[model samples]
Each structure stands twice: as C-alpha cells, then as structure tokens.
Target chain A: MDYGEADRILTLLTREMGRISARAPGARRSQKRFAGRLDRFALVAVRLSGPPHRLTLLEAELEEPFLGLRDRLESSAAAAYVVEVSAALSPEGEAQPRIFGLVLEALAHLAEADGPPSPDLLRAFELKALDAAGLMPALDACAACGGPLAGEGIGFSPAGGGAVCPDHAAADPAASPLSPADVHHLRALARAPLGEPRADVGRAAHRRQASALRTFLDAQLGRRPRSAAFLEQVMET
Target chain B: MAEADPIRRLIHQLSRLPGVGEKTATRLAFHLLRADRAICLDLARALEEVSAQVGLCGRCANLAAIDPCPTCRDERRTDDTICVVERPQDQWALERAPEYRGRFHVLHGALDPLSGIGPEQLQIASLLHRLAPAAVREVILATNPTVEGEATALYLARLLKPLGVKVTRIAQGVALGSEIEYADQGTLSRALAHRHDFG
Candidate 1:
C-alpha cells in the first residue's frame, strides 16, 4: 500500500535481510524510477540506503515478476498464505537463507500450479519453517510423553507442539483428533522435499492436515496468520 | 505559558499527519501563530466541521457529508456504467478528466492478502448490492496499475463476469506527451498488448 502520495512502504522477506520494510518514494507515480518493480510477491534485487532502523529503496531490479500467480485468484491466495507464514516465522534484521529459499521455491511452485498449489507445498513450507524457527515439534514421537505415536486414533496437539499418542492426547485439552491418514499426511509434509508429489489424499484428509498445521502454526505464533483465513476460503472452493 | 502550551499542542498534532515531520510541523505552527488569529480559528473550525459532518456515502462508500453523496444522487449520471476505484482519491483522479459520466464505486482498498485485506474488508458486497438493483451494464475498473490493483481487477472481473455484465480494465499506456523511450518496460508492453488500430 501507499504510505504517502508518491512513496510506498514495502514489506519484503529477503534471504540476507530476513524481513525488512523499505520506503520507495515516487514508486506509485514514477514510471522510470522503480518502474513497477515493487509489486507484491515479485522477487527483485534492490539497493537500499539509510540507517539499520529505516531503509530507503534507492533502486530495484525486477528478477522475477511471477506473473502467473498475480492473475489467478487461487494461486495468488496460496502465495499470500506462504508469504504471510514466511513473514511470521522470520525475525526482522536477521538473515534466514533457508526460510527465504523455502518461500522462493514455494512461490515458484504456486506460480506454475495448474490449479491451486498443492496443500502439500504449503504444509511442507510450514513444517520446514517451524524447524527453521526452532519450533519443529516431535513428529515421530509424542510431543508431550516422548513415546511412539504409532497407531490409529492419534491426536495432534498444537498446545503440546505435535502429535501425541492416545494416552497423552486424552490428557491434553487442546488436542485435535487426527486420523491415521492425517498423521501420515502431516509426516509426509514434514519429510517431503519441496514440490514433492506424493499420492493424492482425499479432500477430507487434506482439510484435516491444513487445519492441524494452521492450529499448530497459530499456537507457535500466538495468532492465526491473517492470510490463513483467505487461504482456507480459497482452498474450500 | 498558556500560549506556549497551545503552540506546543498544535505542533504535536500537526506532526502526526502523514509526511509532516516535526520540523515542518513546527514551521507550520509558527507560520500560523504569525498569521491572522482568524486564520487559526478558521482552520480549527474547518477541521472540526469536516470530522463532524463528513462521512462515507452509503451507496458508493466515498467520503461525503450526505447519506448518499451528490454523485450517487445525481440523476444526470448513468447507472449503466460504474467506474470502480480503490480509493476516493482515485475516483477524484478519474473525475478530473471529466470524460467518464458514470456513477462510481469506491472499494476503499484493494485485495491485498498479505495485509489481511480481503473482499470482506473492501466494499465488494456493497458493490454487488448496488449492481443487484441498478441497471449496471458495464463496470470500468479504474484501479491503479499496480500488482495489487491488477489482482483486484482480475478478482472483480471473475466475480462480475458471472453476472453477465461487461467488465473492462482502463487502458494503460505511456502518458500523453511522454517519450516512448522513457516509458517503463511493463507499461510499454501493456500498451503494445492493448494496441489499437489507427484511423
């Protein structure tokens, strides 16, 4: 959005900068200056000046406009969801090469998706983001009891940080019921490489995985990512 | 002390406005102090009246003093063609040309998901409401030619196309009198994409 008449405040997540907000004056009206390079979700290389607390964008070179995601609603929504999550996970003024790479890769997949980007793509990003943020829960074992989570009727507890066996699940108040399929999907999401194609899961199972990850991510962040609501709406359709 | 206190308060308030740094605010404050007392009082009254009286138009969501703004109520305007803008300022920009003689719908903002602004946050529902009763045949999306603006236009196109109404995007091209060499690549590309045949 525009901060002043001609200037704009851009929130960008960069590999070296982590998350930064820079001011680009005359970005809105000046065709020769930034030259439409400051659009959202477009990867660009920028030269910045000013103090560490406040940076002014001096120049920008458009590297990837990601035009495919910009035109489609579902793809745009997916990009938004991933960007929001990346912003939430990244701390300002710190370099996070892994998270940045994750976001760039996810956005690439989203741009190319014939339909809405696979829920697996977002889930994988989330799981990796949690790891990068040092919040990777014990997916293999019970989060609370540290026991094996090896059976049907398991539950995933966001409050406790991961899946729990029925024993600890019964004790945890915030545990959401997870079917065997949901657990398998979550594990695959955490383990699969970016753009990995696994067997297609049922819609019900997909929704369950998304809901569980959303809850877990919200618990870690202390608030649901605002983009998650729109992402949910887009995915529902 | 009383006079100094008021002056200090004025500078503080003025500095809060966008683009008004403390130095500029102080300069404005001193200027106002040196100017006629009537000017200061008149400025204060104008601000108060604007806040007290001005409100959004019920139909178009544009800032106005009346329930339905004059533009909304203007019988001369055609309901069949509605120009959609992201903000009231954008609507004014289009009206400056004086060529578009249609009613306006202000979205108040664009569909920026990263900022948590979605269809619900904007005046999309009200737009649909306006379309339901009105003889709206064409919706001219005059949103700024930015990424968010394009996404917003595309989103609206998808939403409004189903209603069987014609949705059109304003043509983007090099500004009049500007050299083609100075035009940005994106603008030039779009201009070429939407090129028209010469008479």
Candidate 2:
C-alpha cells in the first residue's frame, strides 16, 4: 500500500529475519535505492539502518527480479500465493533458513516454469512450507484413531490436521472425501522435488489438491490468505 | 484538537490527505481561516466541480472533463501506435516531449500482487478492446521504470504479442542532464545493457 509521499513500508521474509518490515523512503519517486528491488518475489540484498524497531532501507541490490513470472497473470498469481503463504507461516525476528531457501527455490521455479504456472508447483511448495513450519498434515495414517487407512477412499480432516478413517470421517462434519489417487498425489506433493515428472497427477487432480490444500491451509492458519483470491482469478481466467 | 468545531473538523479532513501531518493540517486550517472569502469559496467550488465534471475517458481511461478525452478524439494522432502508461500523470509527462504522436492508455496502476492490484484491477481490458478497432500495429509501454511497472509492461507484451501487435518498452537510463557519477548502479547497468547505436 502507498505510504506518506514516496515512502513505502515493506514487509519481507528472509533467512536472517523470518519476517520484517522496513521503511523504504522515497522508493516510489526515486529509482535510486529500491526501485525494482521492492516488488513481490524479487530477491534482493539490502543495507539497513536505524534502530531494531524502525529499520530503514538504505540501499538494495537486486539479485533476481523474477521478471519471467511478471510476464503472465497466471504465473504471477501462483508466485503471489506462495509468497503470501511464506510470509504468513514465518514468524517475525526468528531465523528459519530452510523456509527462506524453500521460498526462494519455489519462486525461481515459478519464474522459469515454461507454461502458465503449474498448479502442482504451488501444491509442492505449500506441502514443504507446512513441513518447514512444523505443521505438516498427517497423511501416512488416519489423523484420528491412530489407524492406517483401510480403503482406496479416505476423508481429509482439516481440524484433525490430516486424513481420517471412514468411521471418524462420517462423524466429523469437517471431513471431506479424498480418493486414493489424491492421497497418492498429496503425498508426492509433500515430498517430491518440483518439476518431477512423477508428480504429474493430471490437471483435474491438481486442481482438486490445490483446492483441498488451500482449504486445509486456511483452516490451519485461521485466516484466508490474501493471495488466494488472486490465485483463483488467475486460474479461472 | 482545536477548541472550536469548524477548525477541528478542517484539520481532521486536511490531515487525511497524503503527506499532510497534524501540524501541517492545523497550519493550513489557520491560513485558510485568515484568507479572503473569495479564495476559499473558489477553492470549494473548484473541488466540487472537479468531482462532478471530471470523468475518466472511455477509450484511454485518462481523467478528463469529457468522455474519450481530447487525446482519444484527435484525428491527427495515429491509430497504428499506442503508448501505454501506468497513470494519467505519466501520459502527461510523456506528452511534454511532444515528439510522439500516438494516443495513450492509462492503466491507473501497475501489477502489484502485494497490494492486490492485478490485471483485472487495471484498464487492461479496455486497452485490448481499443487495439483491434483502431488497427493498432505497435504498442509503446511507457509505464514507470519501477518493478511493478516493468512487470505490468511485460505482462501486457505477452498478452498483446499473439495478436500480431508489436510491443516495446520505454528506454530507461541516466537522465539527459545528469552526470554519470551521480547515476546509480542499476541505472548505469541498464543503460549499458540497452545501449543504442549512435551516429
């Protein structure tokens, strides 16, 4: 959002600082300090000044502007979703290098990915992000009753934080049905490397997992991420 | 807060404007109180008339007193070329040069995912609609050289290229009168990367 005159208050997620807000004075009017480095998903190195509570952006060197992702609505939206998720999951002032690296890797893939951003890319990132945040949804067995999944069909319980057996699922209003194929795909997405051909579960399945993962994530976060709307619009259009 | 209601209300409203602090707002209110009644009335009327009379152009989306605006209605401007800008102010800045004879398209903003300004939020659909009817051959993207602006331009280029229209971006470099030593590394590097052939 626009701030006083040319200044911008930037919220950034980083390896050193999990999430931080810094004032970029004159960023909007002058191309000298921040210019292209301040946009979403741009990797930058910055010089900071001022006290710990009120850091100011002194200078920024753009590492990668992710210009490729900016070229298409779908790609940009997909990238935005991951960026929002990354920021939300990471707590401020606590360093988590793994999460930071994961975000950078995901963004780089989004920028270089050859088509309209693959839904699987986002799914994969979300899975890893959840794991990094120590919120990985239980998929190995039923989240309730401590029992292994018995059939080809199962139900996902967002509140339960994983898959639930049929008995519990029937009783739990929050449980949504998931096919064995979806379970397989979700497992693959949680651990598989991005762009792995093995993770190609077809577009319809991809869309299903995307919706499910998003719903589950929202439930976990207790608030719908802002980029979810943009992602939906981009995919729908 | 002021002791009087009118003065307090004026300061409150004035402070809502960008960059106007409480001190500045109070100072402006005091100044206005001492000014001639004619000046205050004229300022009020201008504000009212601007809101009532000024509207965005249907074609270019520029804020104007009439639909289509003078720029869109001008026959002398070529239909084959269109210069796209992030805001109406940018179009005016470009117009200061007077060398380009093409019409304009104002996006009102750039692609900023953080702030939720995307393709649908801008005047992109209108720009695309104008292209075919006008037989547009080339598009000059004059969006600011900022990150969002470049991204918006690239996004537009990708969208417009399949239509067989040529897409180009405005050149970014050191200002004409600026010294090389004063230019930032980003600008200098870009200038070197996008250097043009000289006679």
Candidate 3:
C-alpha cells in the first residue's frame, strides 16, 4: 500500500461506486502528499461529496496505486484490466468500500514486481472480485461431503464453484474437472492478499486456475470481455 | 429489498450468468415467471443433460460425449500417421486442413513441465500405444511455435524415437506473404532443411 515517488491525481473507477472524481488539491505541489501520492496501480484515499450519481473529490492522499507499473507495458495492461473490470462492474453510486480496497491491493501487487510476474496477481484479483461480489467458491470442505479436501488428485467444477467432493460431484458430466493441487492453488490465491502473495507457484496450476476462472466468468458475465481475449492474445504472442 | 432476501438472491444468480446483466436478469426472471412452466423446465433439463452426459475423452483426454471419443473410435483412420497436437481445438484446426487424412492422436496438451504438466500426465501413454503397430510410418508433431509447444514436441520426439518408428516434427514455414530475402536466419534455415524433393 505504498505509492512512493509520485503525487498526482487520478479519477479512478471503483467497482463498488461509480466514476468518482477526487483531487489532491496541491497534492503534486507538496512533498508530503506527493510521497504517498496517486500513480497508476497505487491505491489512494479521497474525500468527496455528491448525489447518488456524481462523485466529487474534496481532499486526496495516495495510499498505493501500484507505482511499480509506472514504466512497464505488460503490467500496465494488467493494471488497466483490473481497473477496467472494476469500472465496469461497479454500480453507479453505492458504497462498495471493500471493492475499492480490494482493487487497490490487486493493482499494487501486479505493479510491485519489475518483470512479468506470474499471472497470480490477475487470478487473485479475479477471485477477489468474485468474493467481493459474493461469488467466492467453497474449496475447503468437500462441496458435497463436508469432509476435508486432501489427497493427490482433486477435481474442479467451475459451475459448481469449487472442487466437487466424491459425494457431491457435479451432476453435469461436462463439468470442467480440476486437479486437487489446482483447487489448492486457487484457494491460496483466493485467500492471499493482493500484494506479493504466493503467485509464482507453477504454470500448469496457473493455467488451470485461469481457465477455470475464465469459464466461471463466461458463465457469469454471459460472455468474455474483449479485454480477457486481449490478454490471452498478448500472452500467446 | 433487504440484503438477505431470497428474491434478491435470485436476481444475483441471474446477473451472474453470461450475457445477463442486472437489468436483463431481472427481465428474464420475470419472463420465466409469466412463461409456460414447461419452457423453464426444458431449459433446466438441457442444463442437466450437458453436465451429466459430456466428459473428457479417456484416450486423447479431449471433451466428448463418449469415453474413447469419436476420433479414436473410427477404425478407418490410418493408424500409421498419427498427427500429434496440443489441445482438442488444435485437432479441429488440423481437421480443417483436410490434406492430412491420417488419424490424429491428441496429446490433450503439450508438455509444459514448468506448470507441472509432465509427459506422464498428458495422453502420452495412449500415443505410445498408437505407435506399437508396425504399419505406422511417421509421427508428425504439430505443436505451436511457442516455447512450451516446442518443449512438448522435443519431449515427444525423444520418447517416440526409441520406439523405432520414424519420428518427424512439422516445420513452420515463413508466411506466404514473406519473401526469402526478408526471412530471418531461423526461418531460412528451417526452409532449407525442409525443402521439398523436386523431380
């Protein structure tokens, strides 16, 4: 949650609240406000007042805007992606305080590292979004058995919201099955904080998590956004 | 409405579906309420059928209605020329390339050890079985040009070589629009190595 080396202003799109405008009011002019200032990916605090529609900023202080992504390209897109989704999913004028914090955490982690960090950040954001939206999957006890979820092999059913225990497996034969480790990996992402969480686990697990999330998203969102496809194409190229 | 209300819960579920926005979900929920009871039941039945019936192919491990899958079941397909690919989609991509009339042996996915998807996990065992028949002349590895795909192809080549069947890798030629003059060294080398035998 540190947005050091920058103190500017931004009109962030909150997933919980609609497009809200806030100004630092000489934030860039002073060192104190500038030190913890707004930058891309860094999360910031803002004071504003408006009706149920318009958001106006009264005062501003940068919390963390994921300043690490200030230069790179890939991480920037990743940051933009989270932002875009946050913007799209957020209601026009409601107090989604939790989503604001969650988004900041997600973007900060993606930009914190120098290189192409494992897509762990993206997955975490996605899962967190689901959680904040009250769509977090049940992964610990069997979705069916209410027993522990241990063992070498497990299965993923995106439609089922998590691993289907031996007892409560998906009724659909076409349920996208996932491995046990994948479920564990997903659980880790879901539980971890957005900043510097355990994302660099393995490629297979990441892919599995990604695909599972994608299916869930498609099912929920009704269609994959162009941004998701753009990310895939970029990775493929 | 209250946060815990069941009516709100239904709206939430509808909004979660693909293409169904909050407005649309609300509209659909109302539509179902007024529509014939049987229509809603039909929709529910379709959902049940797909989830309960469709599963991955046991041999190639691709999604299908049956265990062995349609591709593996077809006896008319040539057992000799097994076209290896990464995913089921890639198999379909090749199917569109009808010139390759031989039967296909999907790897289910390419070997990506970094992700912990080893040769052991993919349908490599089934692929090995396809090679046991003596009539098999060549196995063409058609993975993508990506690092993981190349790694997968190399792994397969090494594994299949021991079987004594002629193991070959498909070459990626420069695009039709490219000229030999502008081709990179790697592409130029590949073009030279895979030059067709002219009469």
Rank order (by lDDT, best first):
1, 2, 3
Per residue, candidate 3 scores C-alpha lDDT tens digits across A1-237 of 111222233466655455555444445445433433343444555666766344444555644434345334355456556765665556555556667777766666666666754677777788787777676767787665566666644555566666676545546453455677777777787887765456366777678778877777566656555456535643543
For candidate 1, give the lDDT of residue A62: 78
Q: Give the TM-score of candidate 2.
A: 0.85
Better of 1 and 3 by lDDT: 1
Per-candidate TM-score against the hidden true structure: 0.88, 0.85, 0.42
Q: Quick one: ranking by DockQ, best first?
A: 1, 2, 3
Which window of 10 residues has the lowest lDDT sum in candidate 2 chain A? A31-40
lDDT of 2 by residue, A1-237 (tens): 457656888887877878888889988778655654676678888888887679888988777776667556677777777888888888887887878999888878877878777777777788898999999988888888878766755788888888777777787887777776787778877888765656466777777677678878999788888768867875775
After TM-score superposition, the amount by which residue B122's alpha carbon in candidate 1 deviates from its true location, in angstroms, is 2.1
The top-ranked prediction according to lDDT is: 1
User: Residue B111: error of model 3 in Å?
Assistant: 32
Best by TM-score: 1
Candidate with top DockQ is 1
Instruction: Report lDDT per candidate.
Output: 0.84, 0.81, 0.64
**Cα lDDT tens digits for candidate 1, B1-199:** 3335888989888877876667878999999999999999999999999999999999999999898999999998888999999999998888888778999999999988777888888999989998897499999998888767877887899889989899998988888998897665566767887799998
